[model samples]
Target: MFRSIVKQKIPFLDLKIQHQQIKNEIFQAFEKVYENTSFSGGAFVEEFEKDFAEFCRTDYAIGVNNGTSALHLAMIALGIGEGDEVIIPANTFIATAWGVSYTGAKPVFVDCTADTWQIDPSKVEEKITPATKAIIGVHLYGQPFDVEGVSSICKRHKLFLLEDAAQAQGAKYENIPVGGFGEMGCFSFYPGKNLGACGEAGGITTNNKDYYNELQRLRNHGCKERYYHDILGYNMRMGGLEAASLGVKIKYLQGWNQRRKEIAKKYHNGINNPAIKMQSQPDWADSVYHLFVIVTKNRENLMEYLNKQNIFPGLHYPVPCHLQKAYTHLGYKKGDCLNAEYLSNHCLSLPMYSELTDENVEYIIEVLNAYDDE
Candidate 1:
């Protein structure tokens, strides 16, 4: 018998509800931008950048068009280019690799730890060589990777460390926030992220003033003064309209992140299925639970069961970066990154938004715990 304890459908993500709560505030912010006519990179974007820098506990934050552009600009500012290699985890979204590829640098893949599903620092050193210029440590799934471990390796090898903090807006490692952990950190304010803008937006955070200046110029067509181009650059600047919306959303980020954590705790404590596995959190890292993922060998069956109960889940990624067709020229094989491949096959993301109701969570747990693929 199919259990229908919960009558309402639970979506994997409901950005609409989040927008409704702050609709008026968002409109007001937009009105201000409209009145000032700061449609492009102007006062509104500058204000949000300042606000974001303080929130991340960093000295500066440079706003950009999107997360991918933020990464690309950072790599350019760091002088990463053709023939250079940047180490990245294989289990990440392709945008992480895009940053390196855009700069004509090769992205060397590393396997994630089996338990934490984060870049395994143990595997990083083996991939580094004379051609390696930097290491982009992604705080995958809103959890901080082994910062000390990765930082130690960077120090020993004299490589630049960049934090891909797109999913970890409020996450921290040992009480220090993620964005300021490396030489530069990149963030995305995609509509579904914890602190999302109304439209596309992203930022780079750093303490280095020189990197800050370069990033600003790079994002705005390589010019500090109007119409005086210093170098070749793209039109990757963030709009004032998107930045204005982000300013309103940033205030409630902590509270929303806390609710996500509460839901994750319920899932952890309630699910008793023998076949299911979850990412293990480290003591030193505080995760914001951007995606509450569970791994099961019987993913297809579990997904079908959840769908029948009017619960729609999601997949963070079904393919690892190394296995993507775009990277085929790099000559990577299936068994190269075993951990990432296993996760790509087995991972399932459940409904994980701040707006997820308690009844929805309990019903999900009920359905999951009752499942028996045997």
Candidate 2:
């Protein structure tokens, strides 16, 4: 059965209602694109890049097809290639690992912080080597990773720092946005993201002139002029349509993120069950609560019970990248990634979005508490 008809049920990341609210504005953006017939990189994309770069407090923001492509382009722009190594957290989505692999660089898996589920800064130096060229820090669940600690480690070892800010559109680390701290930051605008566009879209932000210029060329067949390929490149440009939609959505991002934070605060204070552990934030960081996840002992049972009540939840990285069959060449055996394994088994995402009704959130918590009461 379809979910919209179901009454009083919390659905995980409802884009339908969100889209409904902004439909007219979104259509106007599309209409502008249709009027100009400028479907590729044009005024819309450039204006969005400028606006987003300003929002992220970076010198440049280069739009692309998806977060994966953005990451790939960053690695390419940085000239990280075969025989190189890129260290990344084992707990992130597979795209983080694949992005490194896309450039023929090896992915060195690092352990996660038990509390934050981000790359443990203390464990970073141990993974560095002569081949370790870059470190990709993922801001998991819209929480900023420890950029201060991570950047210090990277500087000491002379490694590039890349921010996977896919889930962290409005997140901040010590009053600075998550993307601003890294050498380059990549953001995804997939429908489920906090600052989602109408479809798959992403961008890279950077302060380096070389990287910013290189990213522009990299996304457009390595050409400043049409039909020209200066270097080997791929087609990963963000369409004008997507950019138009994103530009419209970008206007409301901060307010929506604030709303998400409000919802997370409510969830934090209201879920009084011992069986569930809410995701905690560090004092120095401000998370946008993209997922509103929890750690539960009986996660599978809780998921099924919620689903029975027409409430749908989400799972971010049910399997860690290090343990995947494709990455078996990395020789990661079971228990090698201790914290990631623990998180993979225990983490479960609750219904979280800008439009989540208060009654639905309370009722969802009630159901979980009732389950625990048993």
Candidate 3:
């Protein structure tokens, strides 16, 4: 039992430690922005977008103000609207469903696979209706959803496929990256993401030329010309400063993802306890392990024990999107998405940043095993 001598102690996510490592380079990035005072979308943002597109193996990339904005713009470009419906997994951040709502489309909630915590592609076809215009497949918790299966369904049904790659930036399915798998991929650059910005930022990736251009227009003030207006577009431009910060982080995403994979592998192999089970990986997914969540029978007690030891953990979602107050209009009751609702209660994310030390991991496991013995 460790007690803090100085009172204040260890952190769940130490951005100070992370920022210290890249201080010089990050400072220079900020200096360039200050020198130019180019805050809005410009050369800096464009360069980052191009670099990110190549990273995702997509033909084009559009930088936006935030991940939610990216999702909304992607939906708009697909011409999704009031009469149309978008199918989304119930086990995701509210932003996923909200994006569909932003386009004046109804989001149809679908269940997730018990094993992978991702949208169950096998169940997708059953939900398809004449009003189904698109499918927003989410790669939840850094593991890529079954893209091949969902893609086949969409192709057979002639529906658009959008990849919500917010948490799966470096994750892959069978050697292909997640972003390039669907028609368009939306990413978030919130401060805690795998490749985060200093503040809010996001990007979209696509291979289709027409969709890409229309998305570009949608991200701007919906104008193809500098001064002309067109569709009802949201001002979702990614700032130059955020782009610059993200650029520095993007260069290290591969390395950081590799580290996260190593930690996840350790967690999978360690913590020998039957009362708790780590999130399982799909056979085809080359997951980046964005969050090493575990399902536990004694979730509340385990969380309390970890907290007592200063081992801060996170609950990815205590409430599923469909059950949230904002989405009560979806008309889904408690038992509707049982798997998702159950997972929300049992699923808990361990401290999983790239900077987490092996000693700390071992300590966490040791504490977990000790608690399990009780």
Candidate 2, number of clashes: 0
Clash count of each predicted structure: 0, 0, 0
Residue-level lDDT tens digits of model 1 in 137-252: 99988999999999999999999999999999999999888999899999999888888889999999999999999998898888999899998878999999999999898899
Cα lDDT for residue 336, candidate 2: 78
- Relative to the true structure, candidate 3 reaches a TM of 0.96
- TM-score for each model: 0.99, 0.96, 0.96
> Candidate 2: where is the Cα deviation over 4 Å?
1-6
Best by lDDT: 1
TM-score, candidate 2, is 0.96
Return the lDDT, model 1, position 18. Answer: 85
Superposition error at 126 for model 3 (Å): 1.7
Model 3, 1-374: lDDT tens digits are 53222223335566677788998998899899889997998878988988899999899999999999989888888888898999999999999998999879999999998888889998889999999999999888899898988999999999999999998888888988889877899999988889899889999999999988898788788889987878877799999999999889899999999988988888888778888877777789888877888898768888887788778888889999889998877688998888899899998888888998877777777677677625
Please give the range of 10 consecutive residues that has the lowest summed lDDT in model 2: 1-10
- Colliding residue pairs in candidate 1: none
